[model samples]
Target: MKNVITISRQYGSGGREIGKKLADKLGIPFYDNELINLAAKESGFCASVFENAENKATNSLLYSIAMGMNAYGNQELGFTNLSLDDRIYLAQSDVIRKVAQKGPCVIVGRCADYVLKDTPGVINVFIWADIDFRIKRVMESDNLTEAKVIERIQKIDKGRANYYNYHSSEKWGRAENYHLSLRSDFIGIDSCADCIKSYIEYANNK
Candidate 1:
């Protein structure tokens, strides 16, 4: 059976790098922003639209009603009538499902665990780190001041939490929602990847 790994992560925790390295070690495809491009192409929406709506929650009641109508109405007409966020999400969800169906792969962020919840051979992992570690990582990587990095981290994390909580039945960043939750700062990024690979092997054997 294929081993589809979904990694939900905190910003600057090196989750994306870990997922890429893990996929390389496992010889499987890695998907992160690739899903956004695919969703744009598949849905005929601009790539910018997907990027803008990525990990964002739409809380407008009117928008939700419009989205509901679009979901039930004619495809082409309804799609154009739907909100940009709804269109991007539906498109990404479809692409995520198709990607999982293709074979074993590592998918990062974008609520992929929720997208593939019912799919077989899926292992959901969440990666986080100490706030200090995350802030330092982002500051160095993005060439930003500590204050700027902290602000960015908080905003992005809040967006991720809101998006995950709004779209999924489970709470964001909660240990219970994932099969394995790791503190990347404790074990390091490469070690975290190795741990996930080992977990996948163990899970596959079971």
Candidate 2:
């Protein structure tokens, strides 16, 4: 209950659902899109700017040393000197760290694991499912055809991978980078949430 749970998930995986369920079960705050609003308030950037930054194409400019808080702090020093995209990212990272420091919360996506990499009492989780499972989930949610769902999933997944890799020192979805990894296809979404809760209990108790 004292740990911040950061979830990095593949597209169409029910990772957000699981994080919300887990946070509800734990009586904790859940942050996904909410981080953008928080950052907008704190940094004076519009919420849409942060959302749009994720879709921006970046070559190699935004990537830095990826040393959690310190790396972000030292990145080009003057906040005004950074590009709009980098500024939005760092602003969101600032909000992420602030919320994590405040108390235990369930944060989904946005490379939260890497942002809080150096923080203690933080559990990083990766959620993934098989292609078929993901496609079906997306189809149901987006009301898209199978082929369209597949395309959507691939595009979203690629964007997520790029964003995480560009910002974090570690590779996306790599097992070692996270404290726990779950297969949502094999384990039901609710079960995945429960399993994580169990893991946190056992790990913290030890």
Candidate 3:
């Protein structure tokens, strides 16, 4: 099977841009929000349902306390008994693995790194940037005030972290969990993509 590249990113880190670039350079496919449509098709759920669930972080206090590291989600229920959100999560996860199996591709966000944790030939990457850099970047694209951008960044990043932590056994964006980490603001997004490409070449050839 072809190698899969999964990217976990901080909000406004330009991770999607980098992943797209890397996929283009490597002549592979890239998945971001497209996962929703795919998963919807796969699970027979509407895209809006997944989108809504994806945006909201879990509020399971008991699960968080039991997990003891980060705020996690409740898992006391089995698949048949799971809430709609939980079922959507599982459906999306299955789509992630299914796509990965189809061929080499760059997948951004949606806790794909965790979803494919056990899959071989999968390279998990984390993209992050300084808060200031991230804030400025968001402002450029979003037309939001600095303060608003900051709030958005915090909210989105927190949601991502909580979602991933709740669903996965590992911490989101933890350096050790990723095979590669890129500081996109420091090296520039394009260079970050190039760096991953170089790493991939090495990984495949070595």
Model 3 spans with C-alpha error above 4 angstroms:
58-78
Model 1: how far is 85 from its true place, Å? 0.7
Screening candidate 2 with a backbone cut-off below 3 angstroms (N, C-alpha, C), the clashing residue pairs are: none
lDDT per residue as tens, model 3, 1-206: 33699999998999989999999999998998888899999989988888855446734454354334422234434454466766788889889999998989999888888889889999999999999999998999989999999888877887778778777866888899899998999989999999998888889888
lDDT of 1 by residue, 77-106 (tens): 656555556667778989999999999999
* Residue 12 miss distance in model 3 (angstroms): 0.5
Query: lDDT scores for all predictions?
Result: 0.84, 0.83, 0.83
User: Please, what's the RMSD in Å of model 1?
Assistant: 3.1
Candidate 2's C-alpha runs over 4 A off are: 55-76
**All models, RMSD in angstroms:** 3.1, 3.5, 3.5
Candidate 2 structure quality by residue, lDDT tens digits, 1-206: 44799999988889999999999999999998888899999999878878755533333333332223344455766774565667788888899999999999999888888889888899999999999999988888888999888877776776677778777756888999988999998979999999999999988899
Task: List pairs with backbone clashes in candidate 1.
Answer: none
Ten contiguous residues with the weakest lDDT in model 1: 54-63
